[model samples]
Target chain A: MIQAISASDYLQPVHDGAALPPLEAALKNLCRERFRRIDRFIQLALLGSARCVAGRTLQPDCGIYLGSGLGPIGNNILTQQQLIRDAEIPKPVNFVNTLGSSAGFHVARNLGLRGQNFFISRRGASLQAVLGAAMADLTHGVVGQALVGVVEEVTLPLGEHRLRQHLPEDRTLAEGSHWFVLQPGTGDSRSLDLKRFAEFATLEDFLKSVWRTGDRLCCARSMETHAAKTMQRGFDAGALSGPTSAFHDSLEAAWLAAFAVSREPGTLFLVDGHPERGWSLFYLGA
Target chain B: MAGAYIRGVGLSCALGEDAESGVSAMQRRQVRPVVLRLDEFDEPLQMPYYRIPDRAELFDAGRLERLLPPVARAAVAQAGLTPEEIHRLPLFIGSSCFSIGLSESRYAAALAHQSETAIPMPLCGYQDIAAILQRALACRGDTYTYNTACTASANALLGALRMIELGWYRHALVVGAEWANRTTLAGFSGLQIVADALRPFDAARKGIVLGEGIGAVVLSAETDSANRLRVIGGASNCDTWSVTTANTNGKSVAAVLNQALEQTHLRPRQVRGIKAHGTATPAGDTAEALGIRQVFAGLPPLSVLKPYLGHTLGACGINELILFAGALQRSFLPATPGFETPDPALGVQPIITPEAAPDGHYLLNHFGFGGNNTVLVLEKTAP
Candidate 1:
């Protein structure tokens, strides 16, 4: 079993015609040194990861598994505009930061970690992807600790951002950086476990056996509607909802991080996957 | 834990469309890089690029759709998996340019037609490649897309290998793809590292020549009678020295190399040969060479593959792996085509001629941007 020792959830809703609130001051306070040539995506990664690891001494070999839906969107937009629209080559820093792993690099450097660093993406379910990868490494004894983070940046000009994502015109937007520190073995912290079932019936049976009085359930937004509805009906402890007023690509991270930070009394089961493919239940126990 | 076997392989690069033909062309030392001139900028950029021989426009928006599926299909077909196994097969994709070409084309067209409301990135997300492959192959299993620059695909393979070792799945399809896009080309050019030729480990080496390729491998827990190559294990670590390059000191590189060897329970002398990262840049080769020397007292036969297929960045990890594995199956190690003079400062020289690839262990090195370094250990048993 893996344990979730700490978590940081930073979700900021962006008004239609407003600019993103500045993160410089918070980042300066969290980071060890001033980092140059970093874009907003990297800043968000540093912010969330540092905040999660704050007031704690991490193992030097703690691995970093960073996930994102639209990775480094701000830097990518600038680079694409420079190359395609302006007919100019991108600057070196901009080009280098265009990579998703660049953010992981900064996070590793900031925290004095030199362990395994990975940047994995699965669009809407990036949290599951990175968390699964990190848990695997922990289970295999590859690293003693894992720092997993999912960051999504919101660029200016809400209209263009919405168009880029193919969302509705009036759909509210938000930026978020959700982080969790996971470790193997049992401890006083909340225990995290992942269970896979080939069929929905099996998953439901497993959840039924472990359901507590105040335990909550959350069906992934990407889960099939009928299956989600069925799971929702089975659990009476209320469903964990994401920020309804705004959106980011990986809403699952928001839901999971909120629950992790809530200091709640009962277990939270987050179920995902299609009925045909398989079912995955991420259990976070109190 | 048992390692996963390389059951099937497919590749499309500058040499040829199939793995066998690409390896054959490489063994014959066929070095070809077409001159690519981009006149969009004020200073028209010209560089030699090793593109796949598809006869399509380099920047065609639909080129990836046309090029990627066949390569994946070829691997899955070679694996000869059952319909059920194929349906449940997980996908691990690695790439630096995922749907960026399509995004570029759309944004450019929008700019040309309606500049007033044009958006820079019309398509935003890294799931397009996985979605395309899933649709083409009719598989809806889990997907993990990695974007760690050059080490992307190598890390993807490592992830799949560990999961397979843990008995998570019977089989996994790992793909490394990079298609031609203005962002990669123009971005590398702007870094001022685009070289005329890839002369890895040579004293006169300047920088890297960019290339693009699509390579896929089907890894299974059980090996068939014909399977000879098995991905034993690997290690990856970050180099806090610099994000753009590994530390010239080679401590970080050496650390990862030692970590991989220690994890696999192998000593320096047991390694049969080494596939150097060999980007040909001054600092890249220095770091790799110094790292190898730090790990091994007597250097093993080294092979640098970028001469035949230009540095395929993120894809080079798997692309080169397929080519090297194919050569091992044929009982010959590939030669470095561009190594004319060795650098004394680095104390390394790649084999100028093909050598016998004995049945033993080998290490594949992959270093990328963001200070990522990965080393994969492969073993070949007698068929």
Candidate 2:
């Protein structure tokens, strides 16, 4: 079992015509030193990770598993513009920050960690991907402590952003950085477990045994409609719904992190998979 | 530790289109890099590039569609997996340039005609490669796409190995792909690191020659009778010293090397040969050399592969691995073609001629931007 000791969620809805709110003050207060040659994505990552740590001493070997759907989009956009639109080579700092791992590098340096650092992506399901990878490492004893995070940056000019993502014109947008510090063993903190079942019947049976009065259930967006409906009907507790007014590439992270930071009374059972590919249930005990 | 067997392999790079041909071309010491000139910039940019031998346009959007599938199919075919097994096979993909070339083409076209509605990034996400593979192979299993610079694929392989060791799955497909893109080319040129030739560990080494490759390997928990290579354990760590390069002091490099060696339960003398990252940049070679020296008293036969295939960046991890494993299977180690003069400051040298590759363990070093360092261990036995 893995324990979720701390969580930090910085999610703000971005108005269609307004500029992104400044992060300089928040970052200045949170960061150890002024970091130059950094972009917005790196800033968000550092802010979330530092907030999650909250001055608590972390193990030197804590692994960092950072997940994203559209990684470092702001810096990438600027870099691409520099190369194609302006007909000039990208600046060194902009080019180096284009890689997704650059954010993880800053987080590691800030926390004084020298363990496994990975930047993984799976589009809409990036949270599940990174969470699974971190849990696997924790289970296999690769790292006793894992710092897992999922960040999605909203680029300016809402029209362009929406066009890039192929979303509807009026779809509301938001930027988010959700982080969690996970470790092995159960304690007073919330316990997280991942279970896999090859058949729907097996999954239903397992959920039936673990179901409680106030436990909530959330079906991943990728889950088949009929399967999701079936699971929703089986669980008496209310279904957990994601943010309806705002959008990000990895909405699952928002749902999970919201639940983690909430005062929910029971476990949140998150179901994800396909009938042909088997089922995965991420159990977060309250 | 019980490691995963390397069941199948496929590669496409400057050396050749397929794995066997690539190893054969390397054994014959073929080092070729075409001069690439980009005139679209304010100042005309020219550099040496090692591209795949395909006759298509370098920036053709359809290049990835045509190239990635065949390489993946070749690996799956060689594995001889059943229909059911292939359907549930997990995918672990690593790449630095994932569909950015496609994005650039779309944006540039938009700018040419529809400048009013043009967007800088029309397609922004890292799932293009994975989605393409899934559609081509008809697999819907879990996918993990890594973007950790040059060490991307090595870390992907480590993820697969650990999951398989934990009995999570019977088989997994790991792919490392780097395709040509203006962003990568111009970006490296802007860093002032693209050199005329890759001279790793040589005194006159200036910088790296960027290249592109697409390589895939199928790993299984069980080994067949013909399997001779197994991916043992590996380790990855962050330097925290510099994001653009590893600490030139080599302490962080030495730490990761020691961590990998300790995890694999092998001493310095036990490793048969070493495949250095060998980007040929002064600081990169210095860090790798000093780290290797700190770990091993008597240096093993070192091989630098970037000379033959060019620096494939993120894809070099698996591209070089397949080449090295193929040489081991053939009972010989590859030679470093660009090592004419060794640097005394580094106190290391690569083998100038091919040597016997005995059945033993070997380490492959991979370092990338963002302070990422990874070392993979491979064991060879008589087939």
Candidate 3:
């Protein structure tokens, strides 16, 4: 059952810097409008992922396989700068935050949900691992629910014109977090199911593939237009929804649909296609 | 987790450039923890380490952009490819200290008031290392760097194996490197963990003399063939213990190793050999040996690599694995270097000299800070 329900997100234009604490209120208001801020935006999206549960119980078993192409790279640089400024010793919290578990620690701290927290750091296989982890946990009954996400923030220097000039052409090169909460179910639980998922050696094969069929589909957090169009079967109205200056906008799309579903259970589809690895598919349903 | 395969391997260290030389040194039982004489740090501690010594002399400018750059470069280089190749070509890189040499240079300058306002740096810019690897290999598959002290490289290996079994990527490269840095001196000085000399599992073992080395491996699913070290499965778990000290009770380490064995669906008795994390410090060695005895009470013969090369920190996992693979290839197990007598403190007989054991399920174990204790089960390929 791999289908997108409805998607919603908060005012992401606000940076994680000085402007964050104030928006915490605006974030709370969105939960009614279909948004929730558990603590950090990282957890907020993860909390949104809890929407995958199609039942009445408030919670489900959660196993998270969080990935990042660059991770909190900007924050990592900032923390590194702080440590570098002093030669004698490093600040304790700064050192702890620099570890790979930085984001995983935030999600666990904010939600107090302890299932399996893995930070898969490979570039393309990131989503593959996240989706793959959920599937494995699903088989073993590891948890009642699972939240998988990709969260990343950048440092000012990394965003500076000097650095952008240094990057390659293929990379999306942005900052943001996208997450989904996948609740386990058997049978045709997905509003739409992922029929075929394979990695193509060449770009031509990826371009010729199909994603949508006989319905209006919106792709979030990707540049999968060529493929999505093929899936629409020429019915049209299949559009990509986000170039939200965030790496994980697809996560927002998943949550936004959950909020929209309060009116009626709707169907939206989300796909994340990294340049190297193929694509990750999730079956979501009401 | 099911079994994973190791298709290719790479290594860079003091003993030799490739696995063959490193293993030959081990078989001969000749180990020399290199002396650290870098004039940059404030502390003038006479430290002995297992380092290439002059890594600056080793790395030229354009090596990163080459194809199949000798085995050393292949560690990080091979992971760059397309969806078809990328599936089987994931990447995991671990370094105990990537540029401790640079860290030492900066620290040394700052100490001697030579650096002025020049800020000493570790890796100077983070992108330099990965960028070179990325530029050279061009395989945009899955790549990650793990720096969990001594367990760093093993964690990378564990991650690569887990992702593959989960069907994330079909293949992977786990690479580890260490640096000759001022921090190594300060770190060991601060803790007094370094021993008078390099001795592992020896009755008179004093402390660990920090060392530097680097290693890399290309692991893939095309195994059960000749040229593959079958990684059946592994488990990575936290001890939830103090950062500096391992749990004296050895409960978590025991649990972690057992979990890895369980993941491989292998009984404890099926494990034919072990490559222990014998760091040689009184607490560290006793702790690990006890953890080992807990799992394999009437255990198979155990071997430690620390005596061969000073602990390479994050690079230790790959370093140990290379030696283990080499020993298996040569049909001989290297003596646990400097291990003369089994410590009565912990009732265990560390393999003191080279010996042969049936090649079957070999367990590679590693432990690190933040309570990371990981173990892997490797089944030697049938010739």
**Tens digits of per-residue lDDT for model 1 on A145-223?**
9999999999988888888788899898999999999998787888999988899999999999999898888888888
Local error of candidate 1 at residue B6 (angstroms): 0.6
True contacts kept of each: 0.87, 0.87, 0.08
C-alpha lDDT score of every prediction, in listed order: 0.92, 0.92, 0.55
Give me candidate 2's TM-score against the actual structure: 0.99
Q: Write the per-residue lDDT of candidate 2 for residues A53-164, one digit (tens) a residue.
A: 9998889999999999999999999999998889999999999999999999999988899998999999988999999999999998889999999999999988889888
User: In CAPRI terms, where does candidate 1 land?
Assistant: high
What part of the reference interface contacts, as a 0 to 1 fraction, does candidate 3 reproduce?
0.08
What lDDT does candidate 2 reach at residue B21? 98
Clashing residue pairs found in predicted model 1: none
Q: At residue B227, give the lDDT of candidate 2.
A: 90
